[model samples]
Target: KSPQCTPDQHLQTQSETQGLESAQVTKPVEETLSSLSALLISATANPENVLIDALDRKVAFLVNFLLMKYRMKELVRKADIWKMIIQDDEDHFHEIFLRACEHMEMIFGLDVKEVDPTRHCYGISIKLGLTYDGMMHPPEGLPKTGLLILILAEIFMNDNCVSEEEVWKVLSKTKIYSGQMHFIYGHPKELVTKYLVMEKYLEYRQVADSDPARYEFLWGPRAHAEVRKMEILEFLARVHGTEPQSYPSQYEDALRDEE
Candidate 1:
């Protein structure tokens, strides 16, 4: 592994980053970020090698692609990536999405539980390309969170039938029964957003949402409690199914300790 001092040191981070046309340097970094994402596609895939410290697996992914750009092979060479993506991981789904975010920037647009205690989750989404059979996908390595995909699919479906305003209104509706219903299903608060409500109430309300020009924290996290009432035991069971039992709920607890 490379030294964790790229911010302060002037050395090439990896072989992929070592040589490049000045114009193509960013390409290698991006490719390195995309390699090794294929490891997450199967039941046998290993993520332990993905992130070891602060360094993201994207480093490996980017390097792999940078090394093989001329070969023209697909990112997920065996199974169609889209098919794997559509099959949701019901537990630790957010954990999966965070992995994808390292390789793909597009997935970075959706919301989840934020690390900050003071922050409330917000609703946000974006889809690039207007093809009719358009697929919503994350960067090469990101695992899809079932909840995020459901929200995107619903919104995408709505795009074909209703105005964006109508879609947003319906998805953002907060009902009196929301708490009661949380016993069986997780509330959609973190995954769905009321842009108007978010803009008016959250502290960073004025910050621009993601777009071409800015590094936006487009999505935010919402605890099940903020928008639902499930027992903690159920929550623990679901998250642990996807998370390693060895360090289960580490990220979830990070949210609490930050409090």
Candidate 2:
């Protein structure tokens, strides 16, 4: 027969087992803290990296703020930006603002124009003559720049005008159907027929003396002023992986228009 274990021995064994379990649990936590401390040390060693990282965050914040203003059709003020982002840091304000503006222009195809120097009021506008808005992978509150480009190109390709039906046909091919909700563009029909019309990007009007009163789309005054036929042709060429000269008639027409 085996000897019975004493109460003290049993208590001691339980204590040892508990100690071992506690150590096992604590080891990973200690290791994680050590790793984090090393990372912090490495980051602190490179001041430039820290500065760049901070600046990038500020720039991203400013871009998102400006995009929000654009979506709301509101003007941005220098004072407001300083108050919001710069806070008591006037020394870095100019650098941050310039970087943010450059990012806005390069990535969103937006121009941060100073509308009023005295009041320090700024207005955002789309870049002229460029169909691409760098919106291939847009962040929050993405604009409908790509859709606008496609519609403008379609109109240019179809002899400077296209019927509403034809416009819908082209848009449908891109999975943007009329009266349907798109993740990015909202309602395609309303966006095209109403908002774009109001913005003077496209002129939608009743076709000439049609019995059923069909509508047609034409390049609006704003579109004509902002973009050119050649630019539109080049945009199309890029999309098709071909040269603008591939379409001889359109190329000639663009040249004549340019001349």
Candidate 1 matches the true fold with a TM-score of 0.19
Any runs in candidate 2 off by more than 4 Å, and if so which?
1-140
Task: Pick out the ten consecutive residues of candidate 2 with the lowest summed lDDT.
Answer: 1-10
Cα RMSD (angstroms) for every candidate in the order listed: 21.3, 26.1
Q: Kindly state the number of residue pairs that clash in model 2.
A: 0
Q: How good is model 2 by TM-score?
A: 0.50
Best by TM-score: 2
Candidate 1 ranges with C-alpha deviation above 4 Å: 1-33, 42-100, 106-124, 127-133, 136-259
For model 1, how does the per-residue alpha-carbon lDDT over 1-259 read when each residue is reduced to its tens digit? Answer: 1111122133234223222211121232224222333332322336574434222333333223322321232233212222333233335334444554433332222222223334322212221211111122212222223223223322222211122233233323322022232211233332233331243211112213323322111112332112221122223224334332322333443344346
- Give per-candidate clash totals: 16, 0
Residues 1-259 of candidate 2 have per-residue lDDT tens digits of 1112223355365555433423332333234333323333443465655543555556656766887898787999998898777787778888888867755543345778999999999998876554434233323367666567667766666556666876776566455689888655667787789877877888998766677788778877778777888877775565356799977777997898698
